[model samples]
Target: MNVHTPALAKAHRFDEPTSVFARDVIHDLSRAPKRLSPKYFYDATGSELFEQITVLPEYYPTRTELSILRNRSRAISSIVPDGAALVEFGAGSTTKVRLLLGECRLGAYVPVDISGEFLNAQAQALRADYPGLAIHPVTADFTAAFELPEAVRDMPKVGFFPGSTLGNFEPGEACKFLKSARTILGKGARMVIGVDLEKDERTLYDAYNDTAGVTARFNLNVLHRINRELGGDFDVGAFIHRAVYNRDRHRIEMHLISKKALTAEVLGQKFSFRPGESIHTENSYKYSIDRFALLARVSGWSLLQSWTDEAGLFSVHALEASD
Candidate 1:
């Protein structure tokens, strides 16, 4: 199978005899006792594990997001006008998308994801389900500057950003992402996004470090990724998983802490970890409604509608590009 990546893609995908997109940055991050970004967790196995994570009793983000979509879908359908392409940023499972397509008269469906293999498979299924609707699947990092095709470029596109994935980005990066969407959609583009609201620490803690053990696998899988991609030695069993709420940051942080002092090498790089030293894996930030609105305002998007769950555990917001 051939993957058609842009000029930049070759530098990123190693298997294609691709050029490396890093100046030792990849090796630097792969060293244990170091923190890495969460984007790398979508490797095939990690993606499947995340699907399992969503269903666990402790993981409420996906379930809660689905609930909001179900409760307000009719109103959301009414608000987002028809004859417009509904574009999702990281269209993973696309659990909410089926509801949108069935409830709303959408002209086209556009999904962008880093996992092209899974993305194309889902796109094929989506195409079969909605033969009348156009499916333009794009394989690119959502954080990059992408050029839309001519047909999609001219449509009154409405962005659907569910999953509270925006929280994954650091504050500045998140703002830039919102701004990029505005630049692409231009003035008059409507958007509906999900933002997980801040809740109690105890509740947040269990969601990431679940009793089911799948979340741990997902966290450690990053190390496995290093071993496979960059060549690393991660025992995958010599560490303990941790998740905590950083009150100062208002985010849940996941960590893998070494149980004992250990030395390991990966892709020709040596690393040492103390017994208590930890590698920060990911952070899931929960926002207050006011904070989220401020983020949208500062990013050049206007909040049209915002609704919280009956329990106020999550929020679904409708926003539009202002400039």
Candidate 2:
């Protein structure tokens, strides 16, 4: 397998950022109730921290999802047409996809992610392991519209969006994304996605608020990235990390609370944080199977089949495009 790490000279033509990181930081921080897009949390350091988070005993999503994929991969692969291109959204580490790749004779593999360097490195390692497989790594925000390489354009596409990452999006945004994917993959294409099921409050809370503090670091690393890339002065220690289940919203919300009244500078602009004010960083939504199936229907996918662990803590659904 030949590994292609094409120069990102034209990356900006696709979904690459056109504005400075500072601009987004300033705009979001200046909002009434400040919030940041979770996409920013995947810079090299943040990505590493998150990888650590997945392994911590308190974080069950990764291990549980892996178990489901491992046991069901053969059945999962059976539905995927031979020679179908496997396109994964937010392909971090490319670990879970390995299960399916081992079972399926795919025409090509496309892993889309925002972290270019990380994505390339993982893709190269995969190339060495799967020599016969075609590996095309596209470093772009999977949430935005981007073109698939011409190599996979003719092949039937099977989208793999595991890890319940879809839970990060608001329902409307998720719907829009599903629509965009339908356009990209065309009719009859299938999408296999992991969905975190709505469980007990304590279970959900512990998953995000890990005992290891890895998740906390993962959340604060956003501020660290701002300090490094945007020349912001942030006293990382001045903020307390928090993760709470919002029962009404059916999601876990992560925030950084200001320990004291303070002012921070970014891009030469000052923003003030009152004591106890929180900058909302991320939200991970959990869903019931019925709720998700309803979402899939409205989003243009027919829920073909779903597999769950014995405990029903998580689920993976195989959905076919209705159009």
Candidate 3:
């Protein structure tokens, strides 16, 4: 469905193929332990697989966070000033943002994502539903620097970063990202972030290793993406999905282990993997409420308020940028 009631939303591309994806793939695969950025796991196929993962019975973060949003949307909207620009980072299906849009009278809505086509389609759907809302979709890596649309520049900006995606980054990188957001959104801007709380090892393990194997497919799809986009010769079947809870690190680690010794070539470089060798793919760090608050403080944000589900499996915190 294409809706042009509030003007056609324009998409801006900042992640050039030769510069970002290809370069990062070569560099990351060349590393000692061998790793790929989680950001790469969001191609069209990967993105669709992830949406499936969120609904799996074992995946509690999605539903738990959604409950908090649905129940507290008014309380959440109260903090955001009327006519403020809503800038969402890593905007995926645009599902969660719809809850905010229902209550907040946003001046403009900007959804930033790397998957341009998928993002544009979601934005168009949103436009049809909210005809009066100004929707500006930016197709760019939210991690890297990118400019907001000129139209939203003068409007007060409120950042929305849900889905516990902050857990993907290590503490240091997460801090850097928060600081960057502070600069981009400017002072007085507030950010609402979803964070997965530290929970039982069993729960964490089950969440990543769903019984339906959707998470496994989502993990393996990364290799398919590498082969399809970077010209990598990967025997996708040769790798098995593995997720383990790292107690000392307080995180769940997702890896793809080689089922047998094999060699794969990408970007004209061949790499050999020993039997059982694994490429670290993703990490989801669980944080306590206090721990995350400390992180926000260090990153130049003061916590305004936080909401959690009855089980406390997930949390959504509103943080105001400190001057």
Q: Output the number of the lDDT-best candidate.
A: 3
By lDDT, is 1 or 2 better? 2
Please give, for residues 1-323, the per-residue lDDT of candidate 1 as tens digits. 01222332344455531123221324445554477668777777888888899999998888888898998888887767778888888888867898788798887888987778888988998888788998899877777777666677777889888987888888888899999988776679988899999998888888887898999999888788767765568777898888888999999888889899998664344577889888887888889999999999999998999987888888999998885
Kindly list the per-residue Cα lDDT of model 3 for residues 78-124, writing each as its tens digit. Answer: 98999999999999987799999899989999999998878998999
User: Residue 33's C-alpha lDDT in candidate 1?
Assistant: 47
lDDT of 2 by residue, 161-212 (tens): 9997899999999898888888788778999999999999998888888887
TM-score: the better of candidates 2 and 3: 3
Task: After superposing candidate 1 on the true structure, give the runs of residues whose Cα lies further than 4 Å from its correct spot.
Answer: 1-33
Stretches of candidate 2 off by over 4 Å are 1-20
Tell me the TM-score of each prediction against the true structure: 0.90, 0.94, 0.94
The residue pairs that clash in candidate 1, if any, are 227-232
What is the TM-score (0 to 1) of candidate 2? Answer: 0.94
- Candidate 1: 10-residue stretch with minimal lDDT: 16-25
Order of all candidates by lDDT, from best down to worst?
3, 2, 1
In candidate 3, how many Å is residue 278 off?
A: 0.7
